[model samples]
Structures are given as C-alpha cells and as structure tokens.
Target: MSDQSSDAVPAQWSAPTAPGGDPIEKASGENFPVALRLLPPRIREDLRALYRYARHVDDLGDEWAGDRLSALDRIEADVRGLYEERREPTDPVVAALASTIARRRLPADPLLRLIEANRWDQQVTRYETFDDLLAYCRLSANPVGELVLHIFGRATPERIALSDRVCTALQLLEHWQDVAEDYRRGRVYLPQEDLRRFGVAEEDLARPTATSQLRALIAFETRRAEAWLDAGAALVAGLSGRARLAVSGYIAGGRAAAAALRRSDYDPLSRVPKPTSRQIASAWIRSVIRGWG
Candidate 1:
C-alpha cells in the first residue's frame, strides 16, 4: 500500500464491535462493522475503543465547522495521556482507549497517525496527484489496519503489507462514493490529474448527475481499486477460523460497494452506493465455502 511499514505481521484479523449505547451506536454508524458479532467479546471493546477515537477524529476533521486543528491538538495531548498512564482522561474516547493500550501494549504511533491525518484534512482540501492522495492514505486509512494488526498481535512485515493494501483500497472506494458529498463539503478526493485526464471539472461533480466523463472516470477508478484489492487475496487465504472470516468481510464489503457503483453505471452523483444485506451475507457464505485468505 505504502512504504511506511518496514516489518509486516501475519494476516490474521477478522472483526470489530462494541457494547450497546452511544459508542456502540456511533461505531455501528460506520460503513463496515466496527464491532461485529463474529469477534470475541474481549476483542469487541478494544476494537470499538479504537473506532471511537477514529470516529471522533473524523467528525472533528470533516464535520466540524470550527477550529478543527486546535481541537485535534487537544486529542493529541490526550493520546499521550493514554500512554503516560494518566489516572483519568477527560475525553471519553481516550478514557475508553486507555485499558486497551495498556492491555495490548499498543504503540501510540498508529493512533497518532490517525490524528495526524485529520490534522492534514484541516490544511488540505484537494490532492494534485495520485501519489499525493496515497500519501494521505498512509496517514489516514493505513494506520487503522496497522492498529488492528497490533491488536491481533500479528503486526509482522508480511501482514502489514497485506493490511496496507486492503485499507488503502477501502479508503479509495470511500472517496469514490463520496464525490458529491465531499465536493459539497469543500473537499475532493479524486486526483486532480485524473480529473483533467478525464475532462471532469469540479463543476461536473456539482451537477445533479454524473457526466459521462465522470462516470468513465469512476468506472476506471473502481477497476483500479479492485486490482489493488487483489494484492490482499493472499491475506484472506492465509488466516483461519473466525479471524479469517472477519478479514473476508472487509473485502466482501468493498466488492459489494463496487458492485453498487457498477449497477448504477458508476454514477455516484445519482446516489451513494452501499452494500446490501444479501450481498454482505453472500460474502460471508462465499468465504465459508471457498475459504478465506
């Protein structure tokens, strides 16, 4: 996915979850399950704790209209508190993450990277090149996979590589789906070069429907994502038991989102594409029958 990870781990993760209430609702509001039923109860809290941090950071970055950088600075300070063994954290997200950090002995770097991604969001509204976008992913999406590997104790060199591929692919897919929404929010995730190459001006995205060039561009990006996703096939194939199934859901969800885009002729402006229940069930069933990476 990127050059950030030097020593990868084994690909053996499979799920995310949370207990009933505010955190759980926010966690479930995510596209993929943050705390899924397939994972163990012990894994659920830690996974949601991580998601709680990410979700809050994302809100401050993308949704808040105020001084996001200043708010994020506070978040960074609390992240340090988690590692410093502070008796208590005022922020509930950091408070929840404390035990998980101590229990797993997780590095603070991955969590900080996520925060850094949001910090970049405050300064960057558009990416000029594909490489530049990938650089953002290195800070934004890839850290979640890295954190997950660390949680599973499988942050080996090989697994990190595979996780990087999967996380980046998913991040790209999210950008594709949010073309209309991101534009309205004063952000655009599509590379500027690609937009120029395809004759897709920013105005084209502001329209009620995708222009033909925009559709073609979306289709091309979707195919590109699928190819990138294939790099993680070995990851799905290598794991076993519940962990394997959990990882399979991630790929399945991405493929389903791609399918929705295809079904609409890649016209994301018409509607955002999401995975349906049947499609998600099929993904799990197929993995059960066919075997996971």
Candidate 2:
C-alpha cells in the first residue's frame, strides 16, 4: 500500500542487515519459545529461521525509523522474490526463510499474511469487535503455528483449524497483557464494543492502574481467551514424539500465562503479568498427563 516506487527506495533497504540482538533471545518473552533446545538440531534450526524472519518483520513494523509501510512492502517483496520469482532475497532473514520454504514446500500465503498484519497495524488503531480482533490474529499470529506444523510434517487442514484457535488465544492473552503499552503506542487491541459493554472508555487504558470497570472487562476477556485455548488442547493428543511435546509446551505456556493474569486480577494497566518458570513447568506436566481435560 506504500506509494513509494521500488526505484525510490534507499540502498540499505535492498539488503537490510539485522538491526541488532538475537531474535531467538526474544523467545523468553513469548508465551512459548519455539525452537526449544530439546528438539532435534534440524528442527531447532528451521524453527529459529522462521522465528528470525517473523521477528524481523515485527521489528520493521514496530520500531523501524524509516517509513514503516514502505519497509513492510519491501519485506513482502523479498518473500515473493524467494517464492514466486525464484530470485535470491538480499535480506538475510528472507534468505533464511527461502531455505525453509524450499525444504518444507511451505505456501507463500501465510508468510504474506504475516506481512499484511504489520501493514494493517500502520492504518488500523482500533478494532470494532472481538471478531475483528480475531481477524487480526489470523494474519499476525496463526501463521507461526501453521509454519511450525509444516516443519514437523503435521499440517493437515483439521490440525490447522485447531492451531488457529490456540494461536488466536495466545494473541488475545498478549493483547490483554499489553493493553496499556498498546495504548501508549496509539493503538487499542481491545474491541470498542466490549469496552462499551463493560463501561470502559479509551481513556481508561491510559491510567497507571486499572479501574474497577477495566478490571472487570479484562476478566471477561480472560475467560474468553481461556475457552479458546482449551478448544485447541486436542492438538497435543494428535501428535507424537517431539512434535507432541512441542505442541503441549505451547498450550502449557498459554495456561501458565492465563493463570498469571488471573493472579493479577486481570489488571494489566498496573503491571504486566508474567508466568514464572515453576508455573510453566507445572502446566506442562499437567498437559502431558491430563491432555486437555
């Protein structure tokens, strides 16, 4: 959607180096870190490549100094070059993605969708409904789960449907956790309709601590998010070997995060709620034993 032509782009945009830091290191902040060390080396590396590409795309959308829309357009072009045009991507992240695409025979649509989500971020600051928020999750969060399925050779249509529920739940939990932060960034992930239903105003999100109404709204959303996560628990039972463990870890991490939010009485405006290692470990064990009861 950027009006700038390819010719107008700066030279650095051609093959942008990673701005800084290890993209993999960011896993610590995620609901579940992909590319866990316990997985086989090849799977770990492939997932890392995917994570790096995703992180780079997110950074360009969130933190890039130049035209964010133009930057996102360039990343999409790089992905298309690797897939549609069979051209080598100049950007290292896309280059890594190229290898994953070839090895897994992955589709370009999901990758393109992720880029599209970032583009949407530039223009859309508020969602009208919970459905609209889920629509955004389909573009931003679901693709990572799909890509992981392809890497593990488990991407059936049914499994993908299940994964979407899990991914959307994770995305919602993240939105709940970062409500204040998102407000500071001039965006609001909470649906406007839900805000009205709970008597919460947009200005309420800017407060240093959540008001009673805001806390009640978050509680309602938390229950909704937990239901979505539970809907995807069957995904763990459908897998075997490391694939099963990995998927279980994702569900466990979501459960742990949800618990942390509840412990905070769902008040994200005061302080961000985070799951401790012990909570995550306990959830993982229960997931393995109970398998989403």
Candidate 3:
C-alpha cells in the first residue's frame, strides 16, 4: 500500500505544476484526445471537464496505490455534491465538472454510470462470454460517448446508439493491446469462450511471447472490433463542424489502434503494438476527407 501522505495528497488536482499553470497538461496522458486544439475554447473547456472527470475516476480505480475503494466512496459523495445546491464541490475535478454539467444541462445518468463502472472494477475482473464483455463495456466505455454527445448537444437517441458501438469498439481495441499487461494484473478482458475456441489458454498470456493460438485469437477479436467500428462510421458522417472533427478523431483512433494490432501480427505478449504518429496523422486526415466509413 502507498503511504498515507502520498495517498492523501491530491497532486494531480492541485494547481498545475506546468509552466502554463493549467491542469490541462494532464490531458496529454489520455488515450484519446480530450480537447483538440482546433476546437472552440468554450467547447474545449466543456470536453476538458468531461475528460477530467473520467480521468480522475480512472486513477482512483487503476493508478491509486492504496485504499482505492475508500477514495472512490469519497468521490461518490462529491459527485452527489454536483446535484445538491447545499453541498460544495470539494474536489477540484468534481468542481470543474459541476460547472460543465450546469452549463450544458447534462444528465447525471451517464456520469453516474462511469463512476459505477470503476466500482464494478473493484469486484469484477474476468468476463465469461462476449456478451458479458459487452455488458462491461456498456458500463466502462459507452457512458463516455453519451456524455460527450450531451456536451456537444448531439445526444439524440440515434447518435447515442451509434456512439455506443464506437465506444465499445475502442474499448475492445484497448483490451486487445493490453492483453499481456492485464493478465499480469490477474484480470483478463478477453472472453473465456473465445479463448477456449482458439485453444489459447490463460497461461499463454503470461508468456514472454504470444503462442500461435493466442495470435489467432487476437486476430479474431481485432476483426470483431473492426466490425463494431464500421457500424459507428455513420456517426461521423452525420455530424458537422467541430463535432464532426471530434467524432472523426475517434473513428481514426480506432482504426489506428486496430492497425497497430495488425502490424504486430497479434503478438501482443512480445511487445504491444502502437500506431506511429504518421499513421495517426494520416488516418485523421482520411477520416476528415473520406469520412469514417
């Protein structure tokens, strides 16, 4: 367990240590772009609020070295503060997020779902089937897009449905990339049925190199992710202006991550694949000009 002094310090939420003196510096640590520079300042701040909320909850679940569940309990209280006029937003991240929630008239459901996802993480580690995995994604990933759409004033039922597919695909892409590391954490995101089908046993994940069977299974999952991604492509085509660009970035990110898996030939245990900067840039441009589909 980490020492109390360190655990008690909210260094991540403290006034930024960066020369710019903005906590936005922490945004760079995100897997996806939270606030693109080209976006309007107001829109960027809105996205940043969502990003910060997600990021802090993620840290409580994954990065916190001690007493994580207790920390989460405290965070839950602060989240309630956002809804109550009499309660103060005691946490910096929560306070900033409260502002966004107020400004956009965002629903509390998606944000609450995100917090619940991390709480679920405390008890659940492995999934039994693809459907089960998707259920987990509904909690862990889908809320992010739903919240973003709300921020952008684009959370129609149709768009939220497509966004779910995209978000779920992105989550799967990340899981495929982190298979080995996740295995080390005693958590396997891969569906057990798929593992059995491909003859890729759990022990294969602990190896320094991926077995042929493991490679095959990763390839299969990659294709499944691709299909989900393709299903959401229409989401980008349906939007305009900065919302269009933001969704385009998401589609391109999924493509780039999927490409990385292919480039590694699915040998994730040996070394996880990642898209090059050039590949990401190209995909972003293509997504803009050619559309996500």
Candidate 4:
C-alpha cells in the first residue's frame, strides 16, 4: 500500500461545461452508493467521481440498446483520453474521472475491463457454465472492488483476492435479483451447466414463477454466493478504522442480500428479493462488531 498522489500529475482537471452533465442519472440508485455516503467527505467525493465514470461506461453498454457497439467505441475513446489527461475533448464524467485518476493513481486496466464486459453483453447473451459466468463477472464485477481497494490504500494481493470474492458474490446476487429483467433483455446470467444440473431449462426461466428445478438452481447459486461472502470476510479484518467499516459494509450488504434471497426460498422467477433497510442496518452493525472483535 502506497499513497502515490504526489508522484502523479496535479489534480486540477476542469469540469465539463455542457448543460445537464451529471452522470449519476445513468446508474440505478443501487449502483451509485456502494461506498459513496459512508466515506469521509474527500474520499466520498473521489469515490463518487470514480463511480460516475464507471456508471458512464455501463450506460454506454446498456442505454444504446440498438447500437451498443458504436456507443461503446465512443465511450472507450473518451476513457482513453481521460486516462491520458488530454483535455481537448470535454465530457462530464471524463472531466471528473481525469482528476480522480491523476489524484488516486487508479490504473486503466479495471476501467477497460468494465468496458469490455459491457461489449460482451452487447453480443454474448448466454453463459455455458459457471466458469463462463465468472469470466463475465471478472469484467462486470471485479473492477469495482479493485477501485475500492485503491481508495482505501489497501491494494495488496491478499486484499484484492478478498475484494474479488466480495465483488463476484455481489454480482451473482444481482443476477439472481434481476433474473426476470435480464431475461426480458434477452440475456441470462444463469449458467447453462447449473441449469442443466438442476434440470432447469432456459425456457423455464422465462416463466412467471419458478419450477422446482429453477428453485433448486437458485438455491445452489445462493449457496455459492454465501461461500464467497464467508471467504471474503477476512477483507474486513485486514483493514482497520473507517477502512474496516467500509469493507464490512460491503460484505454485510452482500450477506444481507443473500439472506433476503434465502428468505424467498431462492425463487428468482416470481420476485427478486432485496435487503430491506432494517436488514441493511442490522447487517452493518453486526459486521462492524465482528470486525471489532
């Protein structure tokens, strides 16, 4: 862990001048506040700036439902320019992100990986196995955890491993929650291998309610996510003070979400279960105490 802010370019990038340049509008409410509010003021600002940039990349992947490839190319170009600190082209998210990149020394690999995942979404709709879905999670999920590690000054090999577990678990939980919506988009995050193993057909996922096989598959995935949460719980112990609390919040959120899914009997088709505020509060408190202990 090194704080290399002083070794980089000055953090003086300008804001975009265009009207209505906010990027938070591009993300669902759930994606925007992963660690933004719980952080100190300056760190929260930096995290929001990074999140806005990531959200912009995601929007380019998703919003242009008809011409995703072209949109992704443009977004990629903008991201490259931001990384290079070329100010000639001005975009709101890029402007904010350029400063964040210079100040935080955040690498370009994670950002590019996220864009690539979105590109994959544009063309690849079916995952043949759990490994394939995990590959998708590498692109779609792992970067956020890497960025969080960067923010905490804790980008160790061990911490990154824990972060990956947490991120992948969260991504899987989200897929479980958005089963119907993903199906509506002509995509399926459920691996074909598990589907077959549990005797669930792709067509069954489209139905309004889960068949017994579907319930079995969902339960299996829930168990896997729980395992990830447990494996990644060490990330909280590895940190201290506010950094510890932040990591705990992330772990607790995933656990609470999984608990909600369990409460629903892993019935992804009938309804998507989400953690209630009470559950979030309870999980947060428990995680904090656990970290302390």
Candidate 5:
C-alpha cells in the first residue's frame, strides 16, 4: 500500500505529558530496550521515537477497555496523518513518530499492518490452523521486524524473509507463554489443527497443570517456534557491528524464551515461562561468540 503523504504537519502536533502513559512505558520497557541500548545515541533516540509510536498503536488496540474498534480506527487515522505529516499530534508518541518518519523515510505499510492486526484482535478469536495463525502473525508480528530493517536501511528481500521468521517465532513463543492469559482475553493462539491432533480441548487449557494432551500440543508448537529461530539465525550473519548485535540479541532472546518453555515442561496453565536474566546473558554471550567466529 502507498504511504499517506510526507508534507503538512497535522493540527494536533504537540507534546505528550501524560503521567505514567501506557505508550511511554511500553517504549521504555524491557522488550523494546534490547536493541536501543546497543545503538548509537542518535539511532537510539530514533528507535525510541519509532517504538513509542508503535507502542501507542498497540496499546490503543490491546489496553483500551471501551470501544476498542473505534479507538483502533482513530489510531489508524492518526498513523496516516502522521505519515502525511498533515495533522498536529498532541501525543509525544505521535510527535516523535512524525519526526522519525520524516527523517528515516520509513514506509507507512508496516504501521498500517500493525494497526490492522490490532483491528483483527477485535473480531477474530480462534485460529483453526497453523496457516491461519501465520496469517495473524503476518499482521501482528512481522511489522516490527520490517520496522527494524527500515531503521537500519537493510531491507533486502532475503533479510526480510529471515527477519520474518525470527519475528514470527518470537510471536509464537509469546503466545505459548501466555496461554492462560490469552484464554482470559477470549483468544487462543494454538492452532486448532494441532489441538485436535493432540486431543486437547479449549477447556483443558484452563487447568492448573497440563494434561498429557496439553503437554503434547505445547511441545509440538515449541518445536515449530524453535525451527523458525533456527531458520532465521542467518540474519545475524547478514548484518555487522551494532546491527549484528541487535539481531543477535533478538535471536538469543528467542532461544532463551524457548528454553524457558522447555524448562517448564510445556505447561500452559501454571504460569507463563520466562527466561532468567542469567539465561539471557549466557545466550547473548554465545550469540556474540558465534557471530565472531
């Protein structure tokens, strides 16, 4: 899809000063901070700007309690206006985003895809097959990787393919960890085909401990996520310096998360699996060494 425009700042452009703003927190949070710390000052600032915008868009989709569809529509409009630089955005997130778009020449399609994925969450609740879930990942996950590529100015077709695999694997790992919470959200990330193959029902996901069927299903999905990480690992070789470090961090994060799932024995209802700091550090070291070699 063509971008909205690149001229004319919007009428709403102003500083965002909300105390404890959700978007601000997400931008500064642990997950987005991974690559930011490894970047130069200017690039880090730019990433923070981009992250704030994306975070605001996601929060509008995930955290808004009332009229989520309307909120998402507004976010989409704001995104278009931000790209066009036609509307004055009062929120700091939007303000930062507008500047990043102007400076980086970032495309509008990834942002639009992200907003559309949030819109999908409002209507879609179940995934019937792996392909179905992958379609969702195309929207809900892959744009982040695309944005990362755009920031680094390294968006070749092959790199994008590898990045897609890594990003989708990260998304799947997240889903595996959040099985209980997703169920509470009236969503399930496990493809129905696999669930049927393992003879696991939706109700079985709510149990405190997983049954044999649930364990089997989780193991199956975990292996798929691992395969994605393995396939995408070459993305590190395709980059250098800070960009390489950033991609390595991403790969390490996925591997660490997957290891956490394995350590948890694929139980979904007990608690979400999270990698310890030690595990992440070890993985990062290994990633660096491997990259050097």
Candidate 6:
C-alpha cells in the first residue's frame, strides 16, 4: 500500500523477454503457485497476469544479453504507460498487466521497484553485510508480497510487515541455493562479512562440493532464514480462504525448501537442493491446519 523503501525509480527503454524457459513454469518452480485451478477464475487470471509481469522483468534482469538497464527502463516506461499514460504498451506482458493494474489498482512503485532491483543487480554484485543484503531484498523481493497483498485486498501495515519478513527470507533461501551458479555468473549473494566470519572464500562457493566451512556457513545462514520465515508464518492466521491458502503455500514452500537444504547438510554447492513433492504437500497441509487455529 505504501512504498516501504526509498528507492529512486529511474527512467530509460528496451523490452526483450529473457531467453530460455516458460515464465509461468519458471515462477512455479521458484516456491509458490502462480495460478491454481481451485482459485476463482478472476483471481487465477489476475495471478497469472502478475506472474507474467514478474517473469518478464526477471527474465530481462537475469538473462537478457544486451543493455539490461535500458531493457528495464523500457519495461518501466510501459508500466508507467499503464498507470500514468493510460495507453497501450509495446511489450505484451506489460500490455496484459494493464487490466490487473486497473482491477487491483496496484501502484506503479512496486513494479518500478522490481525493475530497480534488477538494476541494482547489475551494479551491486556482492553484499558486504546482512543489512545491505536486506536493503536489496526491499528492492528485489518484498515488493512482490506487497503487490500480492494489494491484489487480495489485504494490504495493511501490519500484514505488510509480516509479508516483508516472509519475502526476505525466501529471497535469502534462493541466494543460498544458487551460490555456485551465482558465483559463475559473477555475483555473490552471500554477505561478505559472513563469508569472512565463517572462513568461506568466494572460490569455495564454486567448488563441486562444499567445503566443511562452506557447509557450516550455509547451515548458519539457513537458520537465519528459517527464523524469519517462521515468524512470518504468523501472517497466515490473519487471513482466510484463498488468500490464506496462497500465503500458506509460500510459508510451506519456504519451510520445505529449508528442510531440503538441511537434508543435504546445507551443502548447496554439490547441487541446488529442492523440496520434493511430498515435502511440499506435507508442509502445505501443516500450514493450512495450523492456520485453522
């Protein structure tokens, strides 16, 4: 409902879909359902539109080969086109987002923040501290939860705070999972201070298997993420029906992914650990049951 961070929105232009995979499927794999069959048609379509917008931005940020900043700028212009100009957009994803923006009255800021996060990604490759990393999450991840709340008509200050915790935790988990892959791409999401504290060299992250020190560092980081995730799960109690189900899926997915990481002894360097279907189902059921309390 409000801008939680004071990130300046930049103006610029280029719209290229990140080349590789299906955006919806890619989003689904990241820990939550975009559009579930059981949701009402309107909500399902709305969620699909949101996912497309997110996927389009993420693909450009993560995979676009040329001038990513300008690409982000182009997308942001289209987003502003939807809200500010009230005109059709050249990019189909941003074009599709028009109705959802009108229907939900979603702010341009969150969409702009998503683009800002990617722009930050291009410039800031390594985080020097945990606090710095959280700032990045404000740009990169928390806005999605904020926008989701607006979509469900549940964006309140209290709920937004809780959602921020859940979103940031999920982002941290993703970074931990992609340590090796990120290193290869010339980025490191793990805070430099933590690496120094745990004696984990950047080179250690690129190893085929994690060193003992690296595993220890990951274990420590996983614990930090789970604490925030558990605290945020309390948000589910305040929600009901489909909104509760969707938020519960997010909590469950985060917990399940954390469990998977633990099962691998927090050695993400060996392989990117993922929650199995049973784990996801079990966590989701537990979350739903707990929410009934």
- Which parts of model 2 have CA positions greater than 4 angstroms off? 1-22, 25-29, 33-35
Worst 10 residues of 5 by lDDT: 1-10
> Which candidate's TM-score is highest?
2
C-alpha lDDT score of every prediction, in listed order = 0.75, 0.82, 0.79, 0.73, 0.75, 0.80
If both were scored by TM-score, which would come out higher, candidate 3 or candidate 4?
Answer: 3
Q: Which stretches of candidate 5 lie over 4 Å from their true place?
A: 1-36
Model 6 TM-score relative to the real fold: 0.89
Q: What's the true lDDT of residue 276 in model 6?
A: 66
Tens digits of lDDT, candidate 5, 1-293: 01223233234433332246433224311222243355687776677676666666666677665566665666667778876767775445565677777777788898889888888888899999999999999898888887888888888889999999988888898898889988988989899888898899999888888998898888889899989989998888889877787778777878888888889998868887877656766787787877631
For candidate 4, the C-alpha RMSD (Å) to the true structure equals 7.6
Q: Assess candidate 1 and give its TM-score to the true structure.
A: 0.88
- Residue 153, candidate 6: C-alpha displacement in angstroms: 1.2
- Residue-by-residue lDDT tens digits, candidate 3, 1-293: 34444225455543222235433444322235332566888988887777777777877787677677777776777787678775776677777788799998888778777788888788898899999999988988999888888888888999999999999998899899989888887789999999999998899899999999999999999999999999988998788878888887777878888988999999889897767556766788877777553
Q: Which regions of candidate 3 fall more than 4 Å away from where they truly are?
A: 1-35
lDDT by residue for model 2 over 90-195, one digit each (tens)? 6677887777788988889889998999999999999999999999999999998898899999999999999999888888898898898889999999999999
Residue pairs clashing in model 3 are none
What is candidate 5's local distance difference test score? 0.75
Residue-pair clashes, model 3 = 0
- Clash count for candidate 2 is 0
Candidate with the larger lDDT of 2 and 5: 2
Give the clashing residue pairs of candidate 6, or none. 13-74
The candidate maximizing lDDT is 2
RMSD of 2: 3.0
Every model's TM-score? 0.88, 0.91, 0.89, 0.86, 0.87, 0.89
* Candidates in order: C-alpha RMSD to true structure: 8.3, 3.0, 3.3, 7.6, 5.3, 6.0
